[model samples]
Target chain A: MSTQTVGTAYRPSLGKRVQGWLAGRFAMIVAVLVLLYLFLPVFYTFIFSFNDYRKSNIEWRGFTLKHWANPCGAAGACDSLVTSLEIGLLSTLVATMLGTLVAFALVRHRFRGRGASNILVFVPMATPEIVLGASLLTIFVNGFTQLNGWFGTDLKLGFWTITIAHIMFCISFVVVSVKARLQSLDPRLEEAAQDLYAGPAETFWKITFPLVLPGIVGAALLAFSLSFDDFIITSFVSGNETTFPKFVYVSYLRGIPAQANVIGFSMFVIALALVIIGQIVGNARKK
Target chain B: MSALAHMGGGGAPATAMPPKEPSGRSWLPYLLLLPGVLWLLVFFIYPLAQLFAVSLYSDYPDYPGYYYQDVNWHNYVRALTDFLPHFGRSMLYAGLATFFAFVLAYPLAYAMAFKAGKWRGIMMILVIAPFFTSFILRTIAWRQILADEGPVAWVLEHLHLLSFMPNGRITETWVAVVAGLTYNFLPFMVLPIYASLERADPRVIEAGGDLYANGFTTFRTVTLPMSMPGVIAGTLLTFIPAAGDYVNAELLGSDTGTKMVGNVIESQFFKVLGGYPIAAALSFSLMALILAMVFLYVRRYGTEELL
Candidate 1:
């Protein structure tokens, strides 16, 4: 209770202050433990990836890169990785473009059923993935069969359907993220450009577009990551196309794959760095 | 709805128009919104409707065509009975996990918002950073830590601390699923609770202390009342997703009895001989159930602040 002390003067005794400081920091310890809990699986898989034998069962049969080098050693590991990337990239493009357009429309214009339109993304979010998955599969099955089913539809499961489904879900994330930003932006900027004799298209490209450009880019990355990361929805519509997570889920039954860790670590590191950089750059730009 | 309703109220028209339709330039918004609208319609609404259609027209297993004919709501009836246990399990698990998440998130959120002056940003960042990777990847990581041979079980078993967890096997169990849900949803809880806890000043507690109240009494009197909104938000965030999640079950839970309604629906669609109509019906029911739960939640606890 001394006035001479800086922050601790009014508090209890010195021991109590020390205890209070430790108590205040107790949350940090829990936060750290949580971080560890969340990432523990990734660390586990990453470490296990180095094990020599395929069925090392994570007992760790000494360190080795046999899994990464021998993708076939991990059973369809290589093919699935490539397939995931292809679908992820295609889905990302569709989602980003469509989402951005939707964001622009809502932010800039007032069409019929605008309220209904805003609720559209919420529908997808609210609907269970199983429902979404089955229905999409049904539509695709019926539509594809009608188009080529006399030829048997060739829909044993592959990339196109998978990509479409991924795009569908990924677009929602993009739309939501971009829409929030577009709402915050001064819509007046576009009007100013228009008043300056700039055409609507030109004004959009020059002024309105640049404002939320970061959000669009960020949303694109988010879409890509989401599309890349999906499992349940992707698994349903995927007749044959195997994305990374899907591959992991399937192989999980046949016994864990060592390459899973390698893939997981690579993806984890890249995604983390992208997010960190985006946040850093975003903060800097704001400043 | 509030979001879309508020648009275009204050914005000046951005496009210069030609003669007669000068005011009609507002249609530009429609043009902009068109693509997003169509995308949602085709991807979201239409598919959902299609799902409903399938639920109403379930084909028996081994039926030839992709989906069979004639409307039949019997699938919903069957799903109700057959999957009732799984649904119950989901609710229980989700409810328990949410309860625990709130408990753990409270202290951490309190620290971040009220105590950790400088470390707040770094701690929040750390909390959310794992989200950068796909959730599936992160959840998959749990597989390793909980494996029969992993450290968790090994440590417990080796330390003779397996009283509650005999032999300390972690994977392929409800505990794993709950752990996964709790771990993944921690931040959702923490952020909201943090926001709520931040609203209360230290002075409030000090006031209670001045009145001769102990720490517990002060916290109960002053801290808990104002943080209810955050508590609500955090609980909702953790509970909803945990209930709907299939990944945690697929990764951590045992096959029998552990399969949630999510897994059941997934089985209908992809793995087990899919019944699109039946699956659709199941999905619709799930949607209805969730909405009902939310509705009840709103009634019991005000909805305006939970979000």
Candidate 2:
């Protein structure tokens, strides 16, 4: 379109022409710069993954692959990473199941108190993590003890508390994502299945479930990421247990070991590879 | 088999006029909803109620970590009186970050929506790929990238841009905190805006060009208005998390001056012995404040629909 204007009979001033040229490319230029800005820290993390720093991973010491070879060489890095994965997996599984059911109920069937249910799902997402964490801590500390009135019966703030908190938050995200996918679906497809003599159970299993599987998978992935990346709420409820983020944060006072960087970068690469593979599989199915 | 045949006959008529509310086994929805609602009521709703109760509890004078049930409202008073500045800083920093994120994200989202064409999927992957890394690691990376002796500071110093800075450094300042907030939540802003813009009809935008109005005018009047829902959703998403965040401030900013409400809540809960009541009070206050602001903001500028 811009090319069509070139070499036209009427010509604007040089300043106007320059302004027009810039205006044409403005969005792309800003997009490229913003993309660079977004990746700046990521690049830094990747580059420093090879740093051979005895004390700190901050400075670019001469490069070495030893950290990459033994990513768990840092004192508690691997332990914390394993703990985070356990919590993340447990929370994601529970949250995805609960959330997907709720999403189906809301989208597929009408019920009393539907609006109230929506608000319940939304309020958790709107509330800050600090508030959620603090509230949960208070409950664990005194609320449960008051209920049971039994010494040593109160829930301890540790692995269970952290997993519970992660599930509590992750449910909202899963519900929202799955609800969106369910809403966008064409009801006619299900109707078509019914018209072909499939019963409710068969139609659901064969038709609706397959269509909604992508949304469920996406929601599960979202839940896992939210649980895994969470630090604030986990920090509050994790009394003695340390997660990966918490370890990195506490270790920051003393310079972080390069192993932390190595692990972080590896996770990034792994997730990216998984997403690309999923896309390829999806494209192949389409073809 | 007979019941199935009858149901199949009923389904054909229903398709011509799609039912607004699909009638099925009445018990099924309730069954599906029961477990999730129970979990939420126990964990989320009940915990909030307990927090409110704890906020009103009086401290047991001799015991530092223990408190008794009492209707002592003074915790709110103490939280407000002591940590007003932290709240103020949180709002200010979060607002600035939201504004900067909007500015930076709008163009990128716009480009991805209209200009990327074949590269749109890859662009999306690129935007979201950063989330795969630990946010703390990324923020700390910013500390290294923008170190006082780093190239950014060096270039700024040579360009005379360092005059505006209080101590001629970027690492240990509010600027760094705001930058980190903006950086961390940039994807939240971008995704919603891109989704809305991508849904928009390209012909509508071309119609603006078809008319006498120029590019900027068309955008101001047409494109921006169409994407207002996205803008509202994006701003709320970015601002809410950024406002409550402490990690960026703790990692990037100085110790005292840049502390936010989250930091105060964290320390009050974790560090201070008899700080539970006050921390709970502060948490309630922050939630109420954010909810009220969100209510008013939505009432004023909200679209008919949002995620």
Candidate 3:
């Protein structure tokens, strides 16, 4: 792998060596700058969680631990966070299950509309959130009204509606992630299991399920994140309900409380910890 | 069960069993697919059709909502005429942000893919870590950073760069919105490009150099072409979301001039009463336009695998 001339024992000139060295350093410098740019806002959000501002969280007020000490001090912020968590968990469960099933069906056993189903799965992922939200709103509003007219029962838009929207969107992402994993699987392992007199069910449970478990877990994680971080679609369908993002949007018009920053930074730290742990475990397994 | 029995016969190895045919009688795949497809049918496909129908409805002047008339086309015309500026702004901002994201992401992705060596995992964690924070909070941080009295404006003012800026500020300007878009979506651009570049054979790149091509020349000929699929995916991911994003504009841009089509649709649906038909029309039009553009772009630059 060495670029040095083997026979001639030739060495590059000082200027050439320096140029080569700089060229390598240049990529590193650009990468550092880009990474810095990406983290600037995150850094700001983390640091400002300690700000002791009375009114606005925008300025560099004197530092204090009051925000973190009472993270739920802001009236509706923690409630909204809880709501988001609930929606995220419920949607992740539903989406992961349904999406994994569809993914298995697509990758393992093909049906008549498999190609069309693939396209159908992708449509939700590709369509803009605004369009998705607006379209879903039309359905809910019209459908709910018709139901009310027919049954004299009120079906309101709230947690259930937002959860549904989240699941609808999260399904596509889960399907894609799980499908990739399923496609990459070695089919021979299943055959080998079957050759050992294992029933199809036993083979699947012993071989295929364990292998695809990581994919399913990864997909579930992705679905949870997508559901948690959703804003626009949740906004459209979440009538008279506030999720974390909705709380931030409404609070932004005024100065957001530092407690919100506390929540944001805490979430970031938790997610970072989870990722690092996942990576360590992944690397450990590889070893 | 029969297939399992056949495989267990021990006369022939189970490994030699041909892949299952698609026409097999097992209904398991269909059963598995049922819930997911049904969910999509009810929420995604059905809503899309309802949206189209709503788009054709006419607004009842005295009422809070619209009534469905048969296939009224004037809603599309009115949306086009009235909100043309917002549509144009959305495309312009999204395009500019995509370009900026590409410029920033390419080198970072390249370094991670080719030069980071053992630091790749840590570097990837850094790239994705910001996304764990709430997107709204990140943009809100940008609002603070780009505020007129904030550090960015102060530095620009002192450095004499504010002369070109409208009203000598970054907040409430298209610059802030675009910057937010670029920053927020940079990870989307980086990850895919990095994936493609990381998969590229190092020997192929070395072969380019072995042919007496300079670094830049080798990159232009070999690396860039191999990474086109990633580039295409990244651009589409960034542009589509950026175009549809109203968060940046709402948070950073002034209410008067910086409205994007997303903002228009949002306000139409949530803020203005009896604006449902117009909003639906706008949504339909935007979807159609984006789909058409994506189709054309994909046809031009995409590989079959990408499709």
Alpha-carbon runs more than 4 Å astray in model 2:
A1-23, A143-155, B1-24, B61-63
- Measured with C-alpha atoms, the lDDT of residue A270 in candidate 1 is 76
lDDT (Cα, tens digit) per residue for candidate 1, span A1-287: 55557555566755544545545677667766665665566666667777876453546678777777865666777788788888878988888888888766655555566566666755565455665676677677767778785775455446888887888877766776676566567657877888899996798789878988867786777677667777767777887667778777777666667777677677777766665676688779889
| Candidate 3 C-alpha lDDT tens digits along B1-307 | 0011111011111223234654555687789999999999999999999999888987666666657576889989999999999999999999999999999988898898889999998998888888778999999999989998888999999999987887778999999999999998888888778877877887887787556346666677887887777788778878988999999999999988998999999999888887888999999998888888887887888444333
Better candidate number, 1 or 3, judged by DockQ: 3
Decide which is better by TM-score, 1 or 3. 3
Per-residue error for B300 in candidate 2, Å, reads 2.5
Residue A224 in candidate 2, Cα distance off native in Å: 1.0
Task: Write one digit per residue (lDDT tens) for candidate 2, span B37-130.
Answer: 8999989999999999989989878887878898998999999989999999999999999999999999998898888988887788888889
Give one digit per residue, the lDDT tens place, for model 2 in A124-157: 8778888998888878866556755866565567
Tell me the tens digit of each residue's lDDT in model 1 across B99-151: 88977877777777776787776676666556554466667667767788677
TM-score of each: 0.80, 0.92, 0.92
Model 3: number of clashes? 0
lDDT of 2 at B67: 85
**lDDT winner, 2 or 3:** 3
Candidate 3 residues lying further than 4 Å off, grouped into runs, are A1-23, B1-24, B61-64
Alpha-carbon error at B294 in model 2, in Å? 1.7
CAPRI docking class of candidate 1: acceptable
Q: Rank candidates by DockQ, best first.
A: 2, 3, 1
Individual DockQ of the candidates?
Answer: 0.32, 0.45, 0.44
